[model samples]
Target: MPYWRLSAYYFCYFAFVGAFSPYFTLYLKALSFSATDIAVLMSLMQVMRVLAPNLWGWLAEHLGVRLPIVRLSALMSLAGFSVFFFTDSFAGIFLGMALMSFFWSASLPLIESVTFAHLGTQGHRYGSVRAWGSVGFIVAVIGLGVVLDWLPIMAVLWGTASVLASIFLCSLAVPEAVRPLAHSASASLGDTLRRPEVKALLGACFLMSAAHGAFYVFFSILLVDHGYGKAMVGGLWALGVVSEILVFMFMPRLMRHYSLRAILLFAFSCAVLRFALTGWGVASAALVAFAQVLHGATFGAYHAAAIAAVNRWFAGRLQARGQALYGSLSFGAGGMLGGLVSGLGWETIGPAWTFTLGSGFALAGLLWLVWGWQPGLGEDGTDRPDGGGR
Candidate 1:
C-alpha cells in the first residue's frame, strides 16, 4: 500500500505547517508589521482554502487522477513562496501568500481522499498513518525555534523554503490511488448534502475551527508577551503535538470503543476548557501545559473522527469533493473568520478576552451537536442509542 510513501507526504506537508504556523507571525512582527497586518497576512492561507480545494478536487476528478495534480500543486507552492525572498512590501507579501496558498490548499484534501482510497476497509488505522505528520510538525517547530534563538529572523524564510522544497520532492514518490468506478444508480452529491445530519456536521466543524482562531494566529505572540522565550514557545507547541501523537496511536482502539459522534462531543468539550485555560492561565506554566495536553482530544481525536465521518457519509465518486468541502467549510471558512475576528479584537479586547470569545464558539458547537446529532451505532456491531461506533 506504499504506507511509508504516503506517510512521507504527510510528514513533509505538516513540517511546512510546523515551521510556518508557530514562527511566521514572529517573523512578521520582527519586520515591524502591525498585529492587524499579521492577521490579514496569515489569514490568506485560510482564504485560499475557501476556493482552491474544490477547484482542484473537481480537476482531479475530471482527469480520473489525483497524484499528478498534487505534484503540480506542490511545485507551484514552492514557486509561489519563493516570491517572499524578493519582496518585503505588504502588497508583495500579500500577493505571495495568496498565490502560494491557492495551490497549497489544494494538496491536503485530495491527499486525504487518496489515503482513504488506499486504506479501503482498514480506515480505522488512519490515525497511525497520520501520526507521522505530527512527528514532522514537532521536529520542524522545535528545530526552527531553537535555530531562531541564535539566528536572525530571516532564518525562518530559509527554513520554510527548505521544507516546501521537501514537500515537492516527497510528492514525487506518492503513487496515485486507484479510483473506484461510479455506479450510475448511486445517489448524487446533492442528495448527500441534503441530509440534515450532513448540514449539522459541517456546521459543527466550522465552529470548531473558528474556535481555534486565537491559538493559531496569536498563541505564540501571547506567550512571548508573557515573557516566554522563543525556544520555550517551540517546546510548548511540541508538547501539544506530542499528546496529539499519543491520541493518534490509539485511535484505532478509540474507533472500536466510541462512535464518531461521541468522540466529537468529547473533543468539543475539551476545546472549551483548553482555550479558557490558555487564555486565563498564561501566567502559570503548569496551567498552560495542562491546557496543551488537552490538544490530544481537541485536535487529534476530533479531526480523526470528523474526517472519518465525512469519508463514510460522502462515499463513492463523491469522495474527493466531500473531503474538499470539509476542508473548505471548516478550516477555510471557519479559520478565516476566526483569524479576522481575533485580529480585530486582539488589541481591543486583549488576549484573555479574545480567547474567552473562542471558548464561546466551542460551546456553540457542542450545543449544536448535542441538539442536532442523533446516535448511530456502537463498535460492537450493534445499534446503540448514544451513537457509539465507527
Candidate 2:
C-alpha cells in the first residue's frame, strides 16, 4: 500500500506547515509589516486554497492520474516559495506567498482522497497515519523555536524551503491508489452539494474554522506580546499538537462509540472554550496550557471527524472533488474571512477581545449544528466490533 511513502508525504508536508504557521508572522513582523498587512498576507494564503484545490481536483478527477498532478504540484510549490529567498519586499513576498499557497493547497485534498482509498475498509485508522503529520508539526515548531533563539527569524524560510523540497521527494515515492468506478446511479457533484445535510455540514465547518482565524494568525504574537519567549511559544504550540496527536491515536475507539455528529459537536464546544480561555487567561500559564489541551478537540478530533464525514458523504467518482470542496469552503473561505476580520479586531478592539470574537463564531457553529445535524454512521456503515487499526 506504500504506507510509509504516503506517511512521508504527510510528514514533510506538515513539517512545512509547522515551520510556517506559528512562526511566519513573526518573520513578517520582523520585516516591519503592520498587523493589518500581516493579516492580509496570511489571509492571502487561505484565499489561494479557496480556488486551487478545486482546480486541481477537477484535473485529477478528469485526467484519471493523481500522482503526476501531485508531483507537479509539489514541485511548483517549491518553485513558488523560492522567490522568498530572493526578496522580502511586501509586493514580492505577497506574490510569493500567494503563489506558493496555491500549489501547496492543491496537494492536501488530493492526498486525503488517496489516503482514504488506500485505507479501503480500514478507514478508521486514518488517525494513526495522520498523527505523523502532527508529530512533524511538533518537531518543526519546537526545533525552529530553539534555533530562532540564536539565529535570525528569517531562518524560518530556509527551514520551510527544505521541508517543501522533501515533500517533492516524498511525492516521487508514492503511486496513485485505484479509484472505484462511478456507479450508474451516483449523484452529480452539484446535486450532492445541494443536499440539506451537505450544506449544513459545510456551513458549520466554515464557521468553526473562521473561529480559528485569530489564533492561527496571531497566537504566537500574542504570547510574545504577553512576555512569553519564542521557545515557550513553540512549546505551547507543540502542546496543542501533542494533544491533537493523542486524540488521533484514540479516534478509532471514540468513533466506535460516538457518531460523527457527537465528535463534531464536542469539537465546536471545545473551540468556544479554548479561544476564550486563551483570550482571557494570557497571564496564567496553567490556564493557557489547559486551553491548549482543548486543541485535541478543536482541530484534531474535529478535522478527523469532518474528513470521515466527507468521505462517507462522497464516494466513488465524487471523492476528489468532495474533499476539495471541504478544503475550499472551510479552510479557504472560512480562514480568509477569519484572518481579515481578526485583523480589524486586532487593530481596533485588541487581542483578547479579538479572540473573544472567535469564540462567538464557534458558539454560532455549535448552535447551528445542534439545530441542523443529525446522527450518522461511519463512512461505510460498518460498526467495528474490532476496530480498524491496520
Candidate 2, residue 215: how far the Cα is off, in Å: 0.7
Cα lDDT of model 1 by residue, 1-390, tens digit: 779999998999999999999999998888899889999999999999999999999998888889888999999998999999999999999999999999999999999999998987788889988999999999999999999999999999999999999999999999888775554554578876876667778999999999999999999999999999989999999999999999999999988888888999999999999999999999999999999999999999999989988877776788899999999999999999999889998989899999998899999999888877777722232332222222
Give candidate 2 regions above 4 Å deviation: 376-390
Which residue pairs show backbone clashes in model 2? none
Give the residue spans of candidate 1 off by over 4 A.
377-390
Best candidate (score: lDDT): 1
How do the residues 145-192 of candidate 2 rate in per-residue lDDT, one tens digit apiece? 999999999899998899999999999998889896665656677776
Query: Candidate 2 — worst ten consecutive residues by lDDT sum?
Result: 381-390
lDDT (C-alpha, whole model) for all candidates: 0.90, 0.89
